[model samples]
Target: MPTLVLLRHGRSTANTSGVLAGWSPGVDLDDHGRKQASAVAERLRPVPLAAIVTSPLDRCQQTLAPVWADRDLPPVVDERFGECRYGDWTGRKINDLVKEPLWKVVQQHPSAAVFPGPEGEGLAATQARAVAAVREWDARVLESHGKDAVWLACSHGDVIKAILADAYGMHLDLFQRIVVDPCSVSIVRYSETRPFVVRVNDIGGDLTGLLPPPKSAGNKDEVDASDAVVGGGAGTV
Candidate 1:
């Protein structure tokens, strides 16, 4: 078995501005996002991580910076974990997108939703690639680090939601029910029989329990989610 921790990149400029960043470049984290990144890094410091995998987007890289600084572990850039390609809708305002007929399809039946344009990618296709990536990574980690290995995957909201949907054995159309906020953490442990979801959208928690007792011992930084007070933020594809 191996533990996979999915962390959504902190709030980005596009998020604050109410735009869908999609695969657009030059979108970095805001000040509040920087704080959220730092806080998440501190929260996970007590847990032993085998590797850190991140999307190639700037926002994801920026979010991983603080964790790299704290743990000195370089992140492996994986494009499979990148944000959904919104095609012609890239960089468009959410309010405007909501007015489109396809927006309702995206919300109600994501499996049938497809972005417009030559490079448009379907929502089901996105989920397929993302789930494949995570499963492949999970197998690799188990082989290299053995069971109990824990790793972090930094990606966008929709991307993480798709992965969670697969982990829960839910269809792509039901994925919209899952909410992956900026800087939020969700954990999944994959075993031979099934996958166990330990936590979802956990802003803060005593993850020390998830860590091996030997590694977590003597770590006074361990604090329960209720004891940790952290602010919330938002995100988009």
Candidate 2:
């Protein structure tokens, strides 16, 4: 099968504002994220991608615009790779959510974690859909582009982590341990026996987001929860 390059969308407005922004509409990439998106073109210049896949979300779409704009291959927008259906959690701040009991389940036993609200779905379901999408795309790409072909997919952090978990045969409960920073690249290649995770959360292209975050003016203690170092964080620097 073709090797897959998983790219998480650049930092977004929600990221800077300390919001989860899961499947939230009108959440576009922030200024710093725009620059990171542009740099992605230059960073991947050396790799010849046979196909481009993306989640049907604005942030992911915008993150990939620069790269596909200059290329002949149009991106395959797949909803399966979209952000986790946070439902009531959508648009909520991470700091506030951390105080909820569900937070513990999400961190420790994500396989059993299900977001509250009408639109919510369990983390296990999210992994199943995302993994299915990637495998289907991999086979399609391999058949059309050949076994040595390389492809790219732009998606949400959690969605990418779930896919990587499947690739490594890791349990969904442990997916939280994988950190996929904004604009980072994680590569995986599938063979007859097993999938090879070539890279995981490989940060590159933009350095500005890696510098220490600026102190928030509002509350002296107020810091963007997205900037936390756990699992690569939200890159709010």
Top candidate (lDDT) = 1
Q: What is the Cα-based lDDT of residue 230 in candidate 1?
A: 50
Clashes of 2: 1
For 55-80, candidate 2 gives per-residue lDDT tens digits of 99999999999988878988989999
Model 1 spans with C-alpha error above 4 angstroms: 213-237
Error of model 1, residue 15, in angstroms: 0.3
Task: Give the clashing pairs for model 2.
Answer: 179-231
Q: What TM-score does each of the candidates earn?
A: 0.89, 0.85
Best by TM-score: 1
Off by over 4 Å in 2: 205-237
Candidate 1 residue lDDT tens string, 132-206: 999999999989997778999999999999999988889989999998899999998887766767688898766
